[model samples]
Target: MTHFRNDMENHDFFDTNIVCSIVIYEWANELSIIDFKHIFDWISQLVGTAPDSIQLAESEAKYKSYKWKYFEKNNVINRREWDLIAYHWFRNIETKSGIRVYCVASTRSFRRLGIYIDEAAVVDVIGVMKQISRTIIEKVEPIYGYGAMQSYLDGPLEYARGINVTTYYSHENIFSQADVDTRERISAFGSEFRKNKRRLNEKLRDVEVINYISAGHLAGIVDGMTLEDWIISGNRGTLNKEGEATWVWRIPDEHERSQIRTDLIRSGLLVVTI
Candidate 1:
């Protein structure tokens, strides 16, 4: 069995502890497409793991051929070689090493490449990201590129249920119980943030507000801090990855959670209505 890191430093968000170390990139075009072979090589060197199963686009179940060595035999499963030629894209990849990669094609109008790293190998997550970044053909601005530690909760916004807190921005990345139509969508490079600056300043006047876009590790954004460094700074229970996920996470003491929340708010990272 994989023994995940339990030390205080890793206690923040290691895999299967109900906590996940995740980095997501949403590209406007197909220019940022990742080279899966590069990723496989990196993971193999990083943690000695390789892809074992793949979930094709629109497929209901993951397909795995024990006869074929996914890593050695074929660097990556091209759509044409696979029996399912109708599916021309990769939806998700499940690796024996406990890391999962999600790639949504541009045909959906929203292309994204998301990597969920195992907590044990969380230290070099940015390395995995940098590997993907090497594929960028042109200097393209991302719709959203951020890393975050997500916890699997019982329900949407379960931590703040019943609280009359107002949410400023949300998207498919955030988990919320509010009606979908009521939630607001803010662009990464838009003037909406500037326009609402005064309102945010007044509401969180004394509080340091950290945007979700900088939640984890983003190249040119972390300010020389590594993913581990960011995780050590504070806890982020405000963000969640999956609601019905069966994974279990270690629930820190209330005082610890409160302190983390307070620290993040002070750093302008998290904002709550109390």
Candidate 2:
């Protein structure tokens, strides 16, 4: 009853959870492992423009595999169909049609889509389809959790939001069990770490720096600082506003860049990058 349903009206779709429910489950073993390659093939066959977009998405999440088959089965409308249905559910036929750009394009060329991001849309038509009433086909997995994105702090968490979305994938504030583990580990280490530095200090003997860096290697040295101070700063000091653990401290010119790096090695703060 998903894509084939009749209250069809201007006929299109809807959704609340992310397309693939991969990130919702806290445990890796809970999901059915499926190859993204098959999804890519299906998308490619259907639209001819998904190769680039899919490849980009895949590369972005290289740390873990991208699974699509389970999502296909859940919606009964194929992933592409689901996207159209979900967007339709979110916006009306008139409103969705007026839009020129979307994260997921419908066609492979501009001729088939409205305009904006430059690349041909691969999902334009699918998103605007109006001929089918939507249904879940089957029940979504009973064990599901919500992942909140923002400002939900004042209210109940996502899981308590009372929406039909039993699972959330890409949003923030959704803490999976793995997240809990990492948080617990950090918590366990917190008290000891806050007790004040015992051996790590301003003394010059402990820090290390390096030279001959690769492009964007984020390793460099500052002037007049002992290696120990460098280590202290890098390990437990002001790491800019973003908390980027790796960085190259500012040096004025190429010569200064070279000199400070050498000085750091001489000062002896451990210098290793890889």
Candidate 3:
């Protein structure tokens, strides 16, 4: 067997998800918890049998355990280190062509989670693989309710156009109409008010200044705008439009480009030539 000492020293760590995907793709037939344990145990045994490999694995494992324990105590593990170790382990296995062993274990659940391997560790790997385990879960859980709020808005918007024609459309006059005509007028006015409010909000929302710079000018503008927005506005050079060179703004009608230019000039980020 290829030795762990030689392999570990040379490998570059990769993301756990990639390793899991590779294993699943390659060993869809016989992957299991038991199989995973067998492979790890076999590797561990090789470490034991080879003095150099054993020393390396022990040294690496000691350092890893110390780092893990430190992070665990201080809560830094959730922020960064765990993923790094899993990444290292995954890279070490795949770099040495040991992916077939993981592939075999991925097919068998029992073998995959068996004794020599901790199911919690595999759970950790699964969590890392999905990019949605402890670290993400902790960060996302607090914001989970926002998703429901979004769904509530999105659900209405999905059928908003057809809502008036639907039977479920609740009009005040439809239920109680002692003064049918007056109620109809009031309801129409209320609907108009709501529609106008929505439109006004949308218009207000649409008004935002967008700035752009070419790749060559990126370093100068990085602090002023997002990388994504910069990329969306393609690279272009400013030409001397008249006696002076001018940068053009390309925002849709809602935004006032002159105001943006004034602000940029006032901030001294942009210079206007006479």
* Collision count for each candidate, in order: 6, 21, 19
Candidate 2 lDDT by residue in tens digits, 1-274: 1221223333322222212111111111222212223322333343332221111122212322122344344543333311111111112345433111122211111101111111122233333221100100011121111111111211112112111222334234463232443233333323322343211111111111211111122223444543335535545222221112212122334454345445554543322110
**lDDT of model 1 at residue 57?**
37
Deviating ranges (above 4 Å) for candidate 2:
1-248, 270-274
Model 2 is weakest, by summed lDDT over 10 consecutive residues, at 130-139
lDDT for position 16 in model 1: 27
Best by TM-score: 1
Top of the candidates by lDDT: 1
| Model 3 stretches with alpha carbons more than 4 Å out | 6-30, 46-274
My TM-score estimates for the predictions, one after another, are 0.35, 0.18, 0.16
C-alpha lDDT score of every prediction, in listed order:
0.31, 0.24, 0.24
